[model samples]
Target: MTNISPIRVTGLSGNFDMEGIIEASMTRDKEKVDKAKQDQQIVKWKQEIYRDIIKETKDIYDKYFERYSKNNIVSKNSYTSLSIKSSDESIVVAKGSAGTNKINYQFAVSQMAEPAKLTIRLNASTPIVQQFPPNASGASSLTIGDVNIPISEQDTTSSIVSKINSLCEDKDIRASYSEMTGELIISRKKTGSSSKLDLKIDGNDNLAQQVANDNGISFTTDGEGKKVATVLGKNLDADITDENGRVIHINKESNSFTIDNVDYNVNSKGNAKLTSITDTEEATKNMKAFVEDYNKLMDKVYGLIVTKKSKDYPPLTDTQKEDMTTDEIEKWEKKAKEGILRNDDELRAFVEDIQSMLFGDVKDIETLRKIGISEAKDYNKKGQISFNEDVFSKAIVEDSDKVYKILAGYSSNSDEKGVFEKLKDIIYEYAGSSDSKFTKKAGIEKSASANANIYSKQIAEQEKNINRLIEKMNDKEKRLYSKYSALEALLNQYSSQMSYFSQGN
Candidate 1:
């Protein structure tokens, strides 16, 4: 009653090949299993191709078109980024940024603002430690404008200045002591007329008097003959005149002033012209890069659509693979994986939607052609687009707002949407959120359960069919083997009976 495989067993009577008979009979079942397995392979390969497509498409959206991206075409950098220049950089410098307005004006700097200073030339021989006695903790305390600075008994004039500065760092005041000049300078850190400083010694007006009496500082006497602390500070005073012969006087606390979208950082009293021009260089670079990546992605996606699905190359069976070299298997699979999404209706529609939007009219802007983007002329590059750097740069200079609106502007109405908005909408339709069509069909690529998509479910069904076919084939093989084994036993018995009859003769 030993259970031996019929495939392994051979016919002993009359040299008949019974194994071949069983295999020939199982041909239909084997073909069914192969077909189901190949279908599953196709589904799996298609999912992989779709994942690659999703990744590439999403990358384009995030890198160049995202709002925060440095190369975002919809932001001010593409339309309003300016090249500002000061005619006389030594007198004034103009810095124009993305949001800075275009301006052509003359800056007449009458005076460069200086911060308030309370200068006192302390005695060269007696340092601050000796002048002011240390408190109970053997540290001297000096209060200036509500900021208390701790000075060690061994602290030098420079050390005390350092300590004062360290404590008043955030207070917009600075203290500096010059060893050679013996000048103790405490100044408000800002410029212009509103900059002010207070150099008062808490509870000791006499100490200030004593320092002044030593020729360290000069004190002003009030109408009542009381001493007053005087520190001189002034605001920035300048006049700005435009090309239209209009003059406006400006007096502010800081030397850095921004007016009419131009930042005038002046340091000297001189006349300088500030002008804002187009940032053509950066815009040109961005446009070219956008076109390059855009075309690359388009070519890839469209290539998937147009590529003809290879026939006759199905998933290799283990037995077939045993005869194929690794390189051969790779080549075969390469053919098999091609055209997994070829002429797919959804993807074709997605590509066409993007193209139509990209080339179609956007608001008053006629097309991307107006901004110097157009389809490639080459027959091989039919669906792909191209960018003209010179034309784009000129367009940005001539009518940047038009270009901006065409490329990056968003609108509630579909026809009014810009290139970014239009493309984003198209991409989103297929792959945007969790509920997106491609997401629901393919699941999120690279996720733990990425393969658990619709196709995978189909593949799972195919797997069930394959397993069922295999089980049926196995059962059929067992039955066929049993039948053949019985025939072989009968033939052997007849042969033995004949042999016994011959022996008796």
Candidate 2:
């Protein structure tokens, strides 16, 4: 027997829109799905806004709070009072400190320290196998300084250079072969009058003699009747004598030195003078930058605390969007996300906690106002700071230490602590890490993304349930169609039988 597919009847079975009835009946279930979707969208928007606040707070902490906390602002102030002028800058450049007295010093430089170097020339046509001649033991050994490095006939110039460098590394020496010059150069690491580079062949290997002949390095007795060896290196010692004939010897490693708290940069031999003068520019710039960052963070806090909520706008449902235009949907969403963090009590309290530190009632320093930093007079400014240049300049010039201590010190008591410590503690509580209040309350994780895991899982479960409910509703619609079809068939059969009876009469 052939299998026949069942036929589906529509309006022929009943004078009713069955599709419309099914849609109307399932409206409540569809609403549940739409509400869940809207809720998920809201959670996502909230997570994003919280993450933004955390990020901005962290940025302010690192850029402003951390820098000002550890730094000695008093030292920065003193740095402005120090200046130096070199009469012959080409010969010697100098930088004076606050301790450097105004004085002129004459100096003469005889020599600069140099690293001892020996470059051994090699024949370009020489074969690698013959680079190291065989010793009495048939295996060649090259002795550099005190270490003996074994070499084989198969070793190339590069390999020999590597062995020499590696074996004699502890002797504060390095060896390399210059491909351009076809020469092997050995140099000492340290450079001073006491520094030395001694190289001699221990065996009767022709390699050493070839190396010596290739380079113009020779050992001879000096006028003092002592054996003196000379290499191709230059400027091993930096020698300078003051005008009073006091000699100063230095290694060639650096061209600068600090004496009597005054730093000197040696260029050539000559006289240079240094002077210390009050320079307010550095202190002024630091204070200005600090104020700018302070104002920015304060503004952010004000927005966090004082922003008003849009109670009229709730997240849009799917059905709601279908009836509305694209522009309307956009407008609705903008309003919905306007007040995710508006008037948050905890965040407002945190802002107030940090703002209280700026009141400035430290012991001797008394107040930030005394140091020329004061809050803006306008209530609309929201605790933003302003600086009086003349007042600050006078304070900084007279007593910078008191200003620094007031800003940097932090005690358990609010009276002793500064803005830096108080702000540090507040930011840590709300925006520091995964344990922060913002992270916990919003159910947000510390990640490169803003997706809240808790809400995402909840949404996934809702979607699953909605799908199952939709499938059940569709099944109920099909069964209703079958029930209606059977009734119609029975009614038609009864009508036919009644006609037959009437014709027989």
Candidate 3:
């Protein structure tokens, strides 16, 4: 019977709508299945709401705890401002902290540093074959400072120069030969006392001497014939003097030097001065921004904790929603979701803990109120913090170092971590770790969602059973029709026989 298709036999002889009657009888059972599906949907809505709240809280945590908390809220350079002036900036320039005293100096550059070079000028008639040491393994190897440059016997002077420059681009050295002078010049790239060309050859090799004589290099010492001017591989020898005519020691390797704890960097010969002044305006602005961000986060969290729960509005079912419009459904769900996280103990405790930390005492400063930061006095304000500009600015200007430490100090005790660090600790406790409150709640919601899925599957199975039962009912109705049709044929034959006997009488 299950293998056969259920016949759709209309009530012909019985004159009745059997399918309609069966549907009316099953309406109550169908509504029970629909309600189960609606309950699952309500659970899904709850999971979504919890997830959104967690996401919002995580966003706040990232902004405050991750980005700005670890930094110095008070600007580092805000206490002392340094101004620099150079008479000849092309020669020298200076920037850095100016100590308690003013700095004044006059600098001069006598000469600039140079690199060592060997320029070889070969005659056109000469056979320019490279002179390698007898122990050299091949005619293609040129070793310089443990670095080997491969060369060929057929390589020309120009090609060798190009190869040397290419290979030594990263080696802090370069080689070039002038076509007009026919000189091969190898020199260090930088000009300083430390920048010296390290050129060495085998003791048996006389390549250096041959190149020097061929390149017209003078080897005559001082007082031999004439005074020889300074050459490459020598430091820049310059005399810099202060206003007191005292010699100031300056090196070619660094442009800047510290005098009386004040640093100065000069590129050209010049006179420069450094003056120190207080910078209170910038420090005040930074303090203001810190207070503003703190108050904003505080307000956000407080509002969420105090949200009112509406017990009258339960999650709407599908049947209930069918009679309502889209806007009506939205408004009803909004009220239903009002108290999902309302008066939550975890959130309330977190808020209270943060407030305690903010209002607590710090080293030297004692309390935030002493630094001109205090909570709102109004009961309706919900503990929003306020900063007095005059008092806070004066505190920063007078003792910025102390004020800075009070807010950003590192401490193992929660009472000592200062306001910002304490808040950061609270955020990490709630949202930072996988086992934190935030993650644990998300896990609970996830489990609830899984349970809702099981409900959905159960409801689906019930629906399949309902469909099977309807098929069986239709099959029974079809068999009843077959039996009624046979009975009608028999009755009609008996009535005809009775009429025939009456006619014979």
Candidate 4:
């Protein structure tokens, strides 16, 4: 069964080379094994090439057409991007959501929302005892709004700031002392008229003395001789002109508000003429990029279909590789693999379908040509496309929705899908691993098993055939050796008898 040439073995008939004769007889058997190996190699090459095609096609689908891609042409916003700007960003700023194209001259501001602020000038480096001493202290508490903070003799200006700021969650107020400004500023965490800060000194006035001191900010005498410490935040009040030209007064708790899906921020007492418009130029650029990628993919597939093969170069045999170096073998195989897919029915059909889908209209509303793209002028370029930016820009400016419909737009009707959707479906027919044409025939590299493919099964069959042939060859060689061994025994017996007769003579 082995294809290794047999060695000559001498016997009683020393003149005869029996193993050499048997080796000569097995030439046809050796050729059969070589032929099977060559056939299997060709099939293997074909399968590998098909997988490469699938990889490239899948890459093309992912780049410009894939939904997850940031610059995917399928989604208009991905390519063009959404943008909104105010006439004056300092005075007011506007932010718009998707599908919001225009936000007309919308707002007039009277006053910006202010947080309730109280400034107690004190250097951060100064100790609380040096700045404000205890007011006949035994135990004292300072209540700001509804939260109570305890006073300590060891308190520094910074430590007292932390004590008040810690209760910010309760009263929505914070305190800070700046050494440079020498200001101990306390402010509400939130803005607007509803947010207010109040101070009340109950028990001992020690804590209040450390804060307001003698500034008359805490427990000041009221008209009825009762002490009151009250401070309030200013609300954001603005007159915004509605779409119907009606002026509406806005008295909100926050400066930022959204109207008709458009978010507006009142910066100061100024007006901002807000407007949102689609950037048609950007949209056209995105569309052109899509067309360029589409052309590139077409050129790749068309090259595979139309390129001519080198008839002289076929998959090499193992014996042939023995005489060649790695680089030489690679060079030979490059020619061998060239145009192997040329005139391939499956690949040809795919290319044709893609070209047809490219030029074809989508739902009778848009086509590649209508959107300023057309097939290449040179027939040699095959199905590659040339983009006209002017036509596309103007078209989108008038009705970009139509352009979207042509590329990739959502619709319940699957039959009315855009070019990208249709082409993706076609590629999936060939490349998709689930019972796809390519997968069913050759199977993909990542498939469950290589033997799951038709070609792999054929290769497996060839392997069995090679094994069977080898076994048969081995059996024949064994039988030949047995026959020659018997003849050697007979010859030895005859020579011995002849020697006995000669001795008697």
Give one digit per residue, the lDDT tens place, for model 3 in 129-242.
444433344344454444556656556776777777888778877887777776767777766666655434433235546754564454333342311212245445456665
Q: Candidate 1: which pairs clash? A: 192-234, 192-235, 192-236, 193-234, 193-235
Candidates ranked, most accurate by TM-score first: 1, 2, 4, 3
lDDT by residue (1-505, candidate 2, tens digit) is 1132112222233455556766777677677666666666776776666666777777766655664453223233232334555567787776543334444455555555556777766554675545655555676665566677786656777887888788887888888888898887788877654557766554343555565566566654446432334453344234455546676765555456666756766776544443445555656666677678767766765775666767788898766788999999999888888766677766677666655656533443347777787767777566577887667766755665555555655577855665555556777887776667765555444463234444455656767776786687677667867765566676566555544654555
> What is the lDDT, from 0 to 100, of the residue 32 in candidate 2?
66
Q: Residue 176 CA error for candidate 1 (Å)?
A: 31
lDDT (Cα, tens digit) per residue for candidate 4, span 157-244: 7777899888655667888888887877878978988777886655334445555563445657546432347777888888877567
The lDDT for every candidate, in the order shown, is 0.73, 0.62, 0.56, 0.70
* Candidate 1 TM-score over all chains jointly: 0.61
TM-scores of the candidates are 0.61, 0.59, 0.49, 0.57
Question: Model 1: how far is 178 from its true place, Å?
Answer: 32
Find the 10 residues in a row with the least total lDDT in model 3: 4-13
Better of 2 and 4 by TM-score: 2
Q: Highest lDDT: give the candidate number.
A: 1
Estimate the overall C-alpha local distance difference test score of candidate 1. Answer: 0.73
Candidate 4 whole-model C-alpha lDDT, 0 to 1? 0.70
* Candidate 3 lDDT (Cα, 0 to 1): 0.56
